[model samples]
Target: MAVQSWTDMLKASKKTALIHDGKRKIHYLFKDGKEMAEEYDLETDELIVRKWRQKSTLGGQGQWQVEVGEQLASPVASSGSDVIKENCSNPVLTRKDTKTSFQWRIRNLPYPKDVFGVLVEASERCIVIKTSNKKYYKKFSIPDLDRSQLPLDCSAVSFTHANNTLIVSYKKPKEILTLEQELLQELKKLKGTAEGDIDCKTQ
Candidate 1:
């Protein structure tokens, strides 16, 4: 889907349903034999979990597969694969999450450390990265804070430049950590069955 018609798809989906679970809401729908489940924070209504599954080619029931669930530690990207686009290649942006911190890296930025500025826009609830040379600019927000209903903390945000990459990091809040742990447990309890269409809820 191109996203322009996502609303129409949502409207057209079969067996569309919503379930209230703790501080989160799970939405389920079926279309073309594929099922999608989304979990949103009831307070912010921000999506925290998304996953999809369909019929298994082998047998009876297909297991639920995650698309964008809780992020985990990722292997470092190879420098060869990071060279992406433009005559002057820009750093490929990547987000890496760990138990204690949320990190973002912009690769291929060859600028000096003094020329770059990383600022947390508290009112806007986003972090802005820009360069004095006007070569690059990026603005991103932390969905974990929004989903946990925690105020964005500028003091927790920091950055460093090394190996032609600008690394931005934010220490994870204790509340956010606890929320994730609880959410993971809750998610494990959700069961889905595809008889004719899909319906998912706590078993």
Candidate 2:
């Protein structure tokens, strides 16, 4: 049967039923003419669904649904858009890179103080800036990087000037490697450097 027809059948059925599509089996539960939950075996199917019963003690009956491909096409479609509109209308603040090496800048500083330190490295959605005495790291996005990069794992970021490399001590080595690979890829695109010319070192 069609997906929508299946959804309608589940919504109308007050009693729970099991649906077998040959490849997988799905348990559908309904309560008061509304779909309540759907359980799927992971070994057969990759998708699972769940429904939360709103208790009066926790909160009154909340508006919830169990459906596939039903997404909020607009902000106002799901809920009021007052907050979303206000946030969207606000001007995006970004760091201005004077050297023209990268499109990076400091954001959210007080007025009349737009000066920022040099950009050391730009990583996945974050950038590292070297201050007079220390290195400040901030998120990679231009609008979110107001002051400095947020310290990960409390260890400050270190940069090697010899090869223009950034060193960050991460608890998980795999995450560090992934970030390094992304940075290398970005550098290649920006500098036109070949893969063989880029060297990444991990300690």
Most accurate candidate by TM-score: 1
Q: What stretches of model 2 exceed 4 Å from their correct place?
A: 1-15, 18-36, 39-43, 58-60, 65-203
Could you report the Cα RMSD, in angstroms, for every candidate shown?
11.7, 21.0
Clashing pairs in 1: 91-107
lDDT string for model 1 (1-203, tens) is 44433434544655333445534435456566767776655555445566667788875557665544443334456658675535547566777555577788788999999999998899999899999999999998886576445688889988999999998989988877766566545544555332335544654
Output candidate 1 Cα RMSD.
11.7
The most accurate candidate by lDDT is: 1
The TM-score, computed over Cα atoms with residue i paired to residue i, of candidate 1 is: 0.52
Superposition error at 94 for model 2 (Å): 29
Tell me the spans in candidate 1 whose CA falls farther than 4 Å from its real position: 1-88, 187-203
- Tens digits of per-residue lDDT for model 2, 1-203: 63343334433444323444421222334443333444333243322333434335555655554332122234454565544543533223232211111222233332221222434244454444444433333434332122123333222232222112222222323433344344334322332222344345652
- The residue-level lDDT of candidate 2 at 61 comes to 59
